[model samples]
Target: MARRSYKTELGCIACEDLSLLGAGKEGWLVDNPNILCAIDTHSVALANRSTILVLGWSDSDGSRLKIRPELSPIEAEYVSAIEWLVFDEIRVIVAGTSCGYMLIYSLRGDLIHKQMVYPGRVIKLRIHGTKKDLIQDTLSGELCVVTPGAIARFDGSDIQNMLLKWFEETHAHFWGLKPKRQGSEDFGNSHEKLPYQLWNVSKYGNCADAAITGIMPPPLIEVQSSQRYYCAVAIGDDAVISAFRLSEDKSRSLVGTILSKVVPATFSTISSLSKMIWRSEQTSPKKPDQKPQSFARAAPLTCLKDHPRKGEKLTLSPSGTLAAITDSLGRILLLDTKALVVVRLWKGYRDASCLFMEMLVNKDIASSSSKYYEPSKSDYCLCLAIHAPRKGIIEIWQMRTGPRLRTIPCAKGSKMLQPSHPFGASMSSSPYVPLEVFLLNGDSGQISVLNRTLDT
Candidate 1:
């Protein structure tokens, strides 16, 4: 009966939904809104390669205006990722291309600095320490670019200064005067002129997941930051989520191992969530007389066993304490990044893009856990949002354990774009900030913003 069963049509579910945001441009929109950041909720900038669109809301009355700007001259380059960066009081939109290029643009869409960081395709671009999360171990404007071959880290100090120099150069070019020196074109296609330090993750192959955090090192490193420790979790084609103590000197961070990242099969989801209980049947444990690795070398104390299903993407928790890995088999492994263990497993979600939304855990929900003899915490919840486009729904799960917290059905829109989280700056502004998740319908390019919060 279970095998024969099928999901209910999402269009039939007459439940509460999000507000309509906007429609795509006559089907020319390739993907969803690549919102780097929003000056405000209504004012957002979306860029994909040569195309750039900025939306703003009028201050006097709440009305939205869509602004499209020509961000780049070259039309052939493919945009892999877009990021909004604010460092040293310098704000810009960074566009990473598939052809191994990073193009920095001003707020007004002027190309500021373009450089070639990786030789291969830039798969993921994470600009750490944005305007919202300003006080990070990372310098004001550093970024991490993940390519299939390697993961590269770029410094922000030079880029911020170069932005100023570009303004000067633009002034020089305008008055029919030439700049003093024809600068070197060692990295980009002659136009890019930024002096940023780039570091490669020489330890992994085809990195799939990565995130920067201030998590405490697991007694492995000799040196630690007094204010906030800099570290990151990285997983590559191997499916091993390796944690490292990133260096204050971003260059040396290329090396160093932190802790393990796998849960043994004996305690895995194969046992079933309802019947699953922690046992001492773990296969890999600490060896006696095991020596700690040096901070200078990149090594993980342990790499968890790979999931049977092939992993598609990795999204870390807002606190950097957990990692959610989505695999081809429609399973999401909620992993504890600190201990490198699978805390929980959620199954039956197919082709889902995950995001984190914070909300207060209510009193009634905590008391209801007693039926399972488990008590929920009341402070805050680690809500896992699984956007399953194929299913035309967003599933919300509570991470305290593998429980289906809520299921948000999609409206009937056949022209829906891909699902994505709000930009990092917006996400980090307030961990518990109430957000209206704009769910896209698969038709007509219409959007629906989730109006109500799951306060209950």
Candidate 2:
């Protein structure tokens, strides 16, 4: 029989060697440093076990920041996850530790903030943001911190607010422009502890990976207008897929209860002069301290149990409506989050890594448009790039309903990488930048971009 052949339509170009600038000068990264994880965007951040090197792509010879996550002398923890966080104009690097702490570092390598999110080890940090229209006020974003047994969410606006306050206070102190007031020593530390929602997703099994799919709008008949609801999805053993509906706790806090009783007692005392018996009870000077609580409840929505087939990874769509999950049985399942149903499935892709990407399908119309004409969001079509190591090929499949577009030969031990969303970038303010994926060859120590598309 003749040997089968593959096409070269999906090709990649060589990327710059990451060990060329300051990192190379300091002899920190070897010729082929065993990169455990990395994120490529405006800058490239490569992490090994303990160190992370970040540098910009615009200037090859520019300075690079080498960061080592600070750990206590008694604690032994290493970096588990890393992501670039954008707060409006300010950008920072956030790294998760094995001991369940989130460390935020400035671009200059200073530790900006650190907090213990969970008792269990942090599995991953996922950030999802969307802009429905061009005239939206700000991007609706949420940061999901995943652990073995739970997941936590930090609203984008809350983070931005906290960071802004911390920076302003630090600037004032640095310039000696602000007077030292009571509790000034704890000013910066207290500001970093932003309120977050946590949920226990361990009901099915330990979560290997999870994502906050989307935040649902409140119902018309809802009583609490301020409470926000969310939908979360997780994957692990015993249960291949599990989803939960997360909402804030409805119970009143100690402070709320105390204030409520005080208001009624004060009004009664004013009306009835004989109500002096309750005066001593309400005259206490000390207030009850609020302890750390989950402040949220997770109700099981659905559970898909598939024994002997554990889920390894989860990739969410730009809109978070769909999820692509890979299982141990060498299959990929496309799941709809809102409906909680598997819409598509592909088998025979063992050890396959997948990422969601976009391709410009209507090139003819794009070319025919005027030079200044901006292409709308509809010009591009969503696609999935599956890098199958066993077959040494990278296949592009149109998301849910389309056929496989093209298959490109790839080397073994190669992995596909996509830059995280353009954090803090407004759809109306900045020009549209289509999402793209890059190829990283572990054997060759070479990086390449997925620049070509079949268009059809």
Highest lDDT scorer: 2
| Structural similarity to truth (TM-score) of each candidate | 0.60, 0.77
What lDDT would each prediction earn against the true structure? 0.51, 0.72
- lDDT by residue (tens digit), candidate 2, 259-315: 446655676677467446455444447543233344356778899987899999999
Cα TM-score of candidate 2: 0.77
Query: Candidate 1, residues 76-128: lDDT per residue as tens digits?
Result: 55666765666434556666776677777665556566666655567777654
Clashes of each: 15, 0
| Candidate 2 lDDT | 0.72
lDDT of 1 at 108: 55
Model 2 steric clash pairs: none
Question: Model 2, 237: alpha-carbon shift in Å?
Answer: 0.8
